[model samples]
Target: MRVFVCLFLVSVLGCSLAEGKVVSKCDLKKEFNNLPESEWPEGHTMTDNFLAKLICHVEKASEFNTSAVNQLIPKKKEEEEAEQWTLYGLFQLSDHLICSDGATPSPDRICNVTCSALVDDHIEDDISCVLNIARKVIDGGFAVERKREFWRMVKLIFQPDCNNETAGNYFAECKD
Candidate 1:
Protein backbone atom coordinates (compact mmCIF):
# COMPACT_ATOMS: atom_id res chain seq x y z
CA MET A 1 0.00 0.00 0.00
CA ARG A 2 2.83 2.41 0.80
CA VAL A 3 4.58 1.76 -2.52
CA PHE A 4 1.33 2.19 -4.46
CA VAL A 5 0.65 5.54 -2.74
CA CYS A 6 4.13 6.81 -3.53
CA LEU A 7 3.79 5.83 -7.20
CA PHE A 8 0.43 7.60 -7.43
CA LEU A 9 1.87 10.77 -5.91
CA VAL A 10 4.76 10.78 -8.32
CA SER A 11 2.46 10.36 -11.31
CA VAL A 12 0.23 13.20 -10.16
CA LEU A 13 3.16 15.52 -9.69
CA GLY A 14 4.61 14.58 -13.04
CA CYS A 15 1.34 15.27 -14.82
CA SER A 16 0.94 18.63 -13.19
CA LEU A 17 4.46 19.69 -14.09
CA ALA A 18 4.13 18.49 -17.68
CA GLU A 19 1.00 20.59 -18.15
CA GLY A 20 2.95 23.70 -17.10
CA LYS A 21 1.40 26.88 -15.77
CA VAL A 22 -1.20 28.35 -18.06
CA VAL A 23 -1.36 32.13 -18.12
CA SER A 24 -5.02 32.77 -18.73
CA LYS A 25 -6.86 35.82 -19.99
CA CYS A 26 -8.07 36.59 -16.52
CA ASP A 27 -4.51 36.56 -15.23
CA LEU A 28 -3.48 38.94 -17.99
CA LYS A 29 -6.39 41.22 -17.19
CA LYS A 30 -5.41 41.30 -13.55
CA GLU A 31 -1.82 42.10 -14.43
CA PHE A 32 -2.89 44.86 -16.81
CA ASN A 33 -5.17 46.41 -14.22
CA ASN A 34 -2.41 46.32 -11.66
CA LEU A 35 -0.13 48.38 -13.86
CA PRO A 36 -0.19 52.15 -13.37
CA GLU A 37 -1.99 54.22 -15.98
CA SER A 38 1.34 55.60 -17.16
CA GLU A 39 2.39 52.11 -18.21
CA TRP A 40 -0.61 51.59 -20.45
CA PRO A 41 0.32 51.95 -24.08
CA GLU A 42 -0.95 55.06 -25.80
CA GLY A 43 -4.41 54.64 -27.35
CA HIS A 44 -4.70 51.16 -25.79
CA THR A 45 -7.34 50.23 -23.27
CA MET A 46 -8.15 47.10 -21.35
CA THR A 47 -11.25 46.12 -23.28
CA ASP A 48 -12.85 42.75 -23.93
CA ASN A 49 -11.60 42.85 -27.52
CA PHE A 50 -8.08 43.59 -26.40
CA LEU A 51 -8.16 40.71 -23.96
CA ALA A 52 -9.45 38.32 -26.60
CA LYS A 53 -6.71 39.28 -28.99
CA LEU A 54 -4.05 38.98 -26.33
CA ILE A 55 -5.24 35.56 -25.24
CA CYS A 56 -5.43 34.44 -28.83
CA HIS A 57 -1.86 35.54 -29.48
CA VAL A 58 -0.59 33.77 -26.40
CA GLU A 59 -2.38 30.55 -27.29
CA LYS A 60 -1.10 30.69 -30.83
CA ALA A 61 2.43 31.31 -29.67
CA SER A 62 2.42 28.14 -27.59
CA GLU A 63 1.34 26.02 -30.54
CA PHE A 64 3.49 27.81 -33.10
CA ASN A 65 5.81 25.67 -35.23
CA THR A 66 9.38 26.32 -34.25
CA SER A 67 10.72 24.70 -37.41
CA ALA A 68 8.90 27.25 -39.51
CA VAL A 69 10.01 30.12 -37.30
CA ASN A 70 12.30 31.36 -40.05
CA GLN A 71 9.25 32.24 -42.13
CA LEU A 72 8.48 35.04 -39.69
CA ILE A 73 11.63 36.87 -40.74
CA PRO A 74 10.86 39.64 -43.24
CA LYS A 75 12.54 39.64 -46.61
CA LYS A 76 14.26 42.70 -47.99
CA LYS A 77 13.05 44.45 -51.13
CA GLU A 78 15.31 45.73 -53.86
CA GLU A 79 15.53 49.49 -54.37
CA GLU A 80 13.60 49.25 -57.63
CA GLU A 81 11.06 46.85 -56.13
CA ALA A 82 8.19 48.16 -54.11
CA GLU A 83 8.64 47.88 -50.35
CA GLN A 84 7.37 44.64 -48.88
CA TRP A 85 6.69 44.11 -45.24
CA THR A 86 6.44 40.87 -43.30
CA LEU A 87 4.79 40.54 -39.93
CA TYR A 88 8.24 40.67 -38.37
CA GLY A 89 9.20 43.84 -40.22
CA LEU A 90 5.98 45.60 -39.35
CA PHE A 91 6.43 44.78 -35.67
CA GLN A 92 10.03 46.02 -35.75
CA LEU A 93 9.11 49.23 -37.57
CA SER A 94 6.26 50.01 -35.19
CA ASP A 95 8.61 49.61 -32.22
CA HIS A 96 11.27 51.76 -33.83
CA LEU A 97 9.06 54.55 -35.20
CA ILE A 98 6.20 54.88 -32.76
CA CYS A 99 6.87 53.02 -29.51
CA SER A 100 10.43 54.35 -29.35
CA ASP A 101 9.01 57.81 -28.68
CA GLY A 102 8.01 56.54 -25.23
CA ALA A 103 4.37 56.53 -26.34
CA THR A 104 2.70 53.77 -28.28
CA PRO A 105 1.36 54.81 -31.63
CA SER A 106 -2.34 55.18 -32.19
CA PRO A 107 -4.08 52.07 -33.48
CA ASP A 108 -4.87 53.69 -36.79
CA ARG A 109 -1.25 54.42 -37.71
CA ILE A 110 -0.06 50.98 -36.77
CA CYS A 111 -2.92 49.20 -38.50
CA ASN A 112 -2.57 51.16 -41.70
CA VAL A 113 1.17 50.69 -42.04
CA THR A 114 1.43 47.12 -40.78
CA CYS A 115 -1.72 45.74 -42.39
CA SER A 116 -0.70 47.25 -45.71
CA ALA A 117 2.72 45.65 -45.52
CA LEU A 118 1.62 42.07 -44.84
CA VAL A 119 2.63 39.72 -47.64
CA ASP A 120 -0.57 37.72 -47.32
CA ASP A 121 -3.12 39.23 -49.73
CA HIS A 122 -6.21 37.81 -48.02
CA ILE A 123 -6.10 39.94 -44.90
CA GLU A 124 -7.83 43.23 -45.66
CA ASP A 125 -8.40 44.83 -42.25
CA ASP A 126 -5.65 45.74 -39.83
CA ILE A 127 -7.31 44.69 -36.61
CA SER A 128 -5.45 41.38 -36.27
CA CYS A 129 -2.29 42.97 -37.51
CA VAL A 130 -2.63 45.71 -34.94
CA LEU A 131 -3.28 43.23 -32.16
CA ASN A 132 -0.33 41.07 -33.13
CA ILE A 133 1.91 44.11 -33.36
CA ALA A 134 0.73 45.28 -29.99
CA ARG A 135 1.44 41.85 -28.58
CA LYS A 136 4.96 42.05 -29.95
CA VAL A 137 5.45 45.42 -28.32
CA ILE A 138 4.17 44.21 -24.99
CA ASP A 139 6.05 40.92 -25.06
CA GLY A 140 9.19 42.17 -26.82
CA GLY A 141 10.47 43.72 -23.58
CA PHE A 142 10.16 47.22 -25.01
CA ALA A 143 7.84 48.49 -22.30
CA VAL A 144 9.64 46.57 -19.57
CA GLU A 145 12.56 49.01 -19.31
CA ARG A 146 12.63 52.71 -19.99
CA LYS A 147 15.48 52.30 -22.42
CA ARG A 148 17.27 48.95 -23.23
CA GLU A 149 15.68 45.43 -23.48
CA PHE A 150 15.03 44.96 -27.21
CA TRP A 151 14.70 41.20 -27.08
CA ARG A 152 11.72 39.73 -28.96
CA MET A 153 9.64 37.86 -26.43
CA VAL A 154 7.43 36.20 -29.00
CA LYS A 155 10.41 34.58 -30.65
CA LEU A 156 11.76 33.51 -27.31
CA ILE A 157 8.46 32.07 -26.17
CA PHE A 158 7.67 30.25 -29.40
CA GLN A 159 11.09 29.18 -30.58
CA PRO A 160 12.66 26.97 -27.96
CA ASP A 161 16.12 27.64 -29.36
CA CYS A 162 15.66 31.42 -29.26
CA ASN A 163 16.38 32.98 -25.92
CA ASN A 164 17.24 36.49 -24.70
CA GLU A 165 20.62 36.56 -26.43
CA THR A 166 19.19 35.19 -29.69
CA ALA A 167 15.76 36.77 -29.57
CA GLY A 168 16.47 39.63 -32.01
CA ASN A 169 19.06 37.78 -34.08
CA TYR A 170 16.60 37.27 -36.91
CA PHE A 171 16.28 41.02 -37.39
CA ALA A 172 20.04 41.45 -37.38
CA GLU A 173 20.54 38.67 -39.88
CA CYS A 174 17.86 40.06 -42.18
CA LYS A 175 19.36 43.53 -42.01
CA ASP A 176 22.77 42.24 -43.03
Candidate 2:
Protein backbone atom coordinates (compact mmCIF):
# COMPACT_ATOMS: atom_id res chain seq x y z
CA MET A 1 0.00 0.00 0.00
CA ARG A 2 2.86 2.39 0.89
CA VAL A 3 4.57 1.66 -2.44
CA PHE A 4 1.38 2.41 -4.35
CA VAL A 5 0.87 5.64 -2.42
CA CYS A 6 4.43 6.75 -3.12
CA LEU A 7 4.01 6.04 -6.81
CA PHE A 8 0.81 8.06 -6.89
CA LEU A 9 2.54 10.99 -5.22
CA VAL A 10 5.44 10.80 -7.65
CA SER A 11 3.12 10.75 -10.63
CA VAL A 12 1.21 13.76 -9.33
CA LEU A 13 4.41 15.68 -8.77
CA GLY A 14 5.72 14.83 -12.22
CA CYS A 15 2.50 15.96 -13.84
CA SER A 16 2.63 19.28 -12.04
CA LEU A 17 6.21 19.85 -13.14
CA ALA A 18 5.30 19.08 -16.72
CA GLU A 19 2.37 21.48 -16.60
CA GLY A 20 4.66 24.24 -15.32
CA LYS A 21 6.79 23.91 -18.44
CA VAL A 22 3.84 24.52 -20.74
CA VAL A 23 4.01 28.13 -21.82
CA SER A 24 0.80 30.09 -21.63
CA LYS A 25 -0.44 32.58 -24.22
CA CYS A 26 0.31 35.44 -21.85
CA ASP A 27 3.87 34.24 -21.39
CA LEU A 28 4.36 33.98 -25.13
CA LYS A 29 2.87 37.40 -25.66
CA LYS A 30 5.23 38.95 -23.16
CA GLU A 31 8.17 37.23 -24.80
CA PHE A 32 7.09 38.39 -28.24
CA ASN A 33 6.56 41.96 -27.08
CA ASN A 34 9.98 42.03 -25.52
CA LEU A 35 11.64 41.70 -28.90
CA PRO A 36 12.80 44.99 -30.40
CA GLU A 37 10.76 46.55 -33.16
CA SER A 38 13.82 46.80 -35.35
CA GLU A 39 14.23 43.04 -35.22
CA TRP A 40 10.89 42.57 -36.97
CA PRO A 41 10.50 43.10 -40.68
CA GLU A 42 9.59 46.65 -41.54
CA GLY A 43 5.98 47.69 -40.88
CA HIS A 44 5.25 44.67 -38.71
CA THR A 45 3.74 45.48 -35.33
CA MET A 46 3.34 42.86 -32.63
CA THR A 47 0.41 43.35 -30.29
CA ASP A 48 -0.67 41.43 -27.20
CA ASN A 49 -4.02 40.34 -28.62
CA PHE A 50 -2.39 39.18 -31.82
CA LEU A 51 0.30 37.34 -29.90
CA ALA A 52 -2.29 35.46 -27.84
CA LYS A 53 -3.70 33.96 -31.03
CA LEU A 54 -0.25 33.46 -32.48
CA ILE A 55 0.76 31.41 -29.47
CA CYS A 56 -2.23 29.16 -30.04
CA HIS A 57 -1.03 28.44 -33.55
CA VAL A 58 2.47 27.83 -32.25
CA GLU A 59 1.13 25.35 -29.71
CA LYS A 60 -0.07 23.16 -32.57
CA ALA A 61 3.48 22.86 -33.92
CA SER A 62 5.88 20.08 -32.94
CA GLU A 63 8.15 20.78 -30.00
CA PHE A 64 11.29 20.50 -32.11
CA ASN A 65 9.97 23.02 -34.63
CA THR A 66 8.77 25.32 -31.87
CA SER A 67 12.16 25.21 -30.20
CA ALA A 68 13.35 27.75 -32.74
CA VAL A 69 10.23 29.77 -31.98
CA ASN A 70 11.24 29.86 -28.32
CA GLN A 71 14.64 31.26 -29.29
CA LEU A 72 12.92 34.40 -30.57
CA ILE A 73 12.39 35.54 -27.01
CA PRO A 74 15.28 37.93 -26.96
CA LYS A 75 17.68 37.98 -24.05
CA LYS A 76 19.84 40.59 -25.73
CA LYS A 77 19.44 43.22 -28.42
CA GLU A 78 22.64 42.46 -30.29
CA GLU A 79 21.66 38.98 -31.48
CA GLU A 80 17.97 39.69 -31.90
CA GLU A 81 18.00 40.14 -35.66
CA ALA A 82 19.61 36.76 -36.26
CA GLU A 83 17.00 35.17 -34.08
CA GLN A 84 14.31 37.14 -35.88
CA TRP A 85 15.52 35.99 -39.27
CA THR A 86 15.60 32.40 -38.11
CA LEU A 87 12.01 32.75 -36.90
CA TYR A 88 11.10 34.51 -40.12
CA GLY A 89 12.45 31.69 -42.24
CA LEU A 90 10.49 29.14 -40.24
CA PHE A 91 7.26 31.07 -40.73
CA GLN A 92 8.01 31.62 -44.39
CA LEU A 93 8.54 27.91 -44.84
CA SER A 94 5.46 26.82 -42.93
CA ASP A 95 3.04 29.34 -44.35
CA HIS A 96 4.00 30.37 -47.85
CA LEU A 97 7.14 28.75 -49.16
CA ILE A 98 6.69 25.04 -48.46
CA CYS A 99 3.52 24.44 -50.37
CA SER A 100 2.20 21.18 -51.88
CA ASP A 101 0.34 22.99 -54.62
CA GLY A 102 2.23 21.04 -57.31
CA ALA A 103 3.68 24.17 -58.83
CA THR A 104 5.49 25.41 -55.74
CA PRO A 105 9.21 24.61 -55.43
CA SER A 106 10.85 22.84 -52.49
CA PRO A 107 11.75 24.90 -49.42
CA ASP A 108 15.50 24.40 -49.77
CA ARG A 109 15.34 25.38 -53.42
CA ILE A 110 13.47 28.55 -52.54
CA CYS A 111 15.87 29.41 -49.72
CA ASN A 112 18.84 28.87 -51.99
CA VAL A 113 17.32 31.04 -54.66
CA THR A 114 16.51 33.81 -52.18
CA CYS A 115 19.96 33.63 -50.60
CA SER A 116 21.54 33.73 -54.03
CA ALA A 117 19.54 36.81 -54.91
CA LEU A 118 20.64 38.47 -51.68
CA VAL A 119 24.24 37.52 -52.41
CA ASP A 120 23.94 38.95 -55.89
CA ASP A 121 22.95 42.30 -54.42
CA HIS A 122 26.52 42.70 -53.17
CA ILE A 123 29.60 43.48 -55.21
CA GLU A 124 31.72 41.00 -53.21
CA ASP A 125 32.03 37.20 -53.53
CA ASP A 126 29.37 34.84 -52.19
CA ILE A 127 31.32 34.18 -48.97
CA SER A 128 31.83 37.86 -48.39
CA CYS A 129 28.19 38.69 -49.06
CA VAL A 130 27.03 35.93 -46.72
CA LEU A 131 29.42 37.13 -44.04
CA ASN A 132 28.32 40.70 -44.47
CA ILE A 133 24.64 39.75 -44.20
CA ALA A 134 25.43 37.69 -41.12
CA ARG A 135 27.03 40.72 -39.54
CA LYS A 136 24.04 42.84 -40.40
CA VAL A 137 21.73 40.20 -38.99
CA ILE A 138 23.40 39.93 -35.58
CA ASP A 139 25.79 42.88 -35.35
CA GLY A 140 29.06 41.44 -33.92
CA GLY A 141 30.50 38.05 -34.78
CA PHE A 142 33.68 37.11 -36.62
CA ALA A 143 32.94 37.31 -40.35
CA VAL A 144 34.15 33.83 -41.30
CA GLU A 145 32.59 32.19 -38.27
CA ARG A 146 29.27 34.02 -38.62
CA LYS A 147 29.15 33.17 -42.30
CA ARG A 148 29.24 29.44 -41.52
CA GLU A 149 26.88 29.84 -38.58
CA PHE A 150 24.42 31.86 -40.64
CA TRP A 151 24.27 29.30 -43.43
CA ARG A 152 23.86 26.47 -40.94
CA MET A 153 20.96 28.28 -39.28
CA VAL A 154 19.41 29.02 -42.65
CA LYS A 155 19.60 25.37 -43.60
CA LEU A 156 18.17 24.29 -40.27
CA ILE A 157 15.04 26.40 -40.71
CA PHE A 158 14.59 25.04 -44.23
CA GLN A 159 14.59 21.48 -42.88
CA PRO A 160 11.26 19.63 -42.87
CA ASP A 161 11.43 19.44 -39.09
CA CYS A 162 10.86 23.16 -38.50
CA ASN A 163 7.43 23.91 -39.91
CA ASN A 164 4.75 24.99 -37.42
CA GLU A 165 1.54 26.99 -37.11
CA THR A 166 3.38 29.86 -35.38
CA ALA A 167 5.40 30.30 -38.56
CA GLY A 168 2.31 30.22 -40.69
CA ASN A 169 0.60 32.88 -38.61
CA TYR A 170 3.69 35.04 -38.71
CA PHE A 171 3.78 34.96 -42.48
CA ALA A 172 0.08 35.70 -42.72
CA GLU A 173 0.33 38.64 -40.37
CA CYS A 174 3.62 40.07 -41.51
CA LYS A 175 4.06 39.31 -45.17
CA ASP A 176 2.54 41.50 -47.81
Instruction: Write model 1 residue lDDT over 35-107, tens digit each, in one string.
Output: 5554445666656444444434543543221111122332334655433222222122333322222343333
Q: How do the predictions measure up, each by TM-score?
A: 0.28, 0.28
Q: Which pairs in model 1 have colliding backbones? A: none
Off by over 4 Å in 1: 1-22, 42-44, 63-71, 75-176
Clashing pairs in 2: 91-167
Task: Compose the digit string of candidate 2's lDDT tens values, residues 116-151.
Answer: 222122212322232334345455443565455445
